[model samples]
Target: MTDDPAATFARARAAAGVLFFNDNDQIMLVDPSYKDYRDVPGGYLERGETPRQAAEREVAEELGIHPELGRLLVADWAPSEAEGDKVLFLFDGGTLTKDHLDGIRLDPGELVGFQFHDIAHVHDLTISRLARRLVHAHAAHLDGSTRYLEHGEWI
Candidate 1:
């Protein structure tokens, strides 16, 4: 265990993403400046907002587009290396067009680059395991079924 006091216990965290597809069927993703991982277009929720509202706010703040939010794909708990414990929420949104990307106003301090990849290519994003579960759940959600577990079962 580490000596950092912030690592004491898990913290409840909320995030969202728009799984928009383009005409070519690629999902939109962004590379954050603060991390080397490519993640979905949303961030941690603010103090007074619901997860859905946070998703809308994050998408607009980071990408400058209003994402059409969708079904609750994955809502589960996971551990955070820095924040200790965290609860994650991943939503479902349909595919978007290149025009949406072209019109985006990115937050320079947070996002560095962006890309759209095929659903099958989502594994290349190099994000958190929770994200991987969300991606898998997205596919499962699209297939009209999702079988992910709660916090304890997540590894």
Candidate 2:
């Protein structure tokens, strides 16, 4: 709605999260103390940090575990009334064994606890856009292909 090019240019926000699985194939989710809904382990990028770095850093900060990100799962361009313009990336954290689970020490200020949730029930516990993104990312993980989403829709 602006005549100036600067004003018209979209300043998209970016965030990165990691999707970890258990032996049962359930995905790991965290309960954030600051939010009503559950979320994957991740957060916004710091100054001069890349999405992948932010993904790894956030996991360590929030979960107290450092696991290599296996692959890019979903890179989504999400625009909506609730979230505004943004790009979100979900990375595969591969499968978490018992040792990894035992290592999850939540940062009490950021996270309350972590749980391995069935993929089918994840939708009921998170925001709609995030749920959709996770579903797409999960499928991509199974096929070893990266996925792109626009507002959580495969495109």
Candidate 3:
């Protein structure tokens, strides 16, 4: 392998998402119009935008709500065979009040619908890797600590 720094390093794609919860401790998941599985409100980061900014933008674009996101819950480095290396950031979206939930407006172009799911059943609603990430994120939220994961597992 060549020693040139530029040639030796590969650029990894990045995505940011927010984990929203309700008073009942259920996680909010969004149904993307293009995906078969449910996901949190997030998307690929735009050019030059920070992960947090991307998360905020995605929530507004997908759900049409601008709730202030809290601390980082999980930073996962998950590399996929089809998508290549990816770094995902999950942020805390503090419990949503009834008013906030009532104001949700799903963007027809991006998300078809959104629902609250119990933590125990997150695996049934989303992909395995994502389910693991969400579970870790929820644990971090409860303990007020951040987590670093590789392929959705703590390392």
Tens digit per residue, CA lDDT, model 3, 65-130: 899999999999999999999999999999998788888999999888888999999998999999
lDDT of 1 by residue, 86-129 (tens): 66666676666567767888899889888777667665666557
Off by over 4 Å in 2: 1-4
Please identify which of the two predictions, 2 or 3, would achieve the higher lDDT against the true structure: 3
Q: Per-prediction TM-score, please?
A: 0.77, 0.93, 0.96
Please say which candidate is ahead in TM-score: 1 or 2. Answer: 2
Per-model lDDT: 0.69, 0.91, 0.95
Worst 10 residues of 2 by lDDT: 1-10
- Residue 49 lDDT in candidate 1: 86
Q: Give the TM-score of candidate 3.
A: 0.96
Residue 73 in model 2: shift from native, Å?
Answer: 0.3
Candidate 1 deviant stretches above 4 angstroms: 1-11, 128-131, 146-155
Number of clashing residue pairs in every model? 6, 0, 0
Q: 34-59, model 2: which lDDT tens digit per residue?
A: 99999999998888899999999999
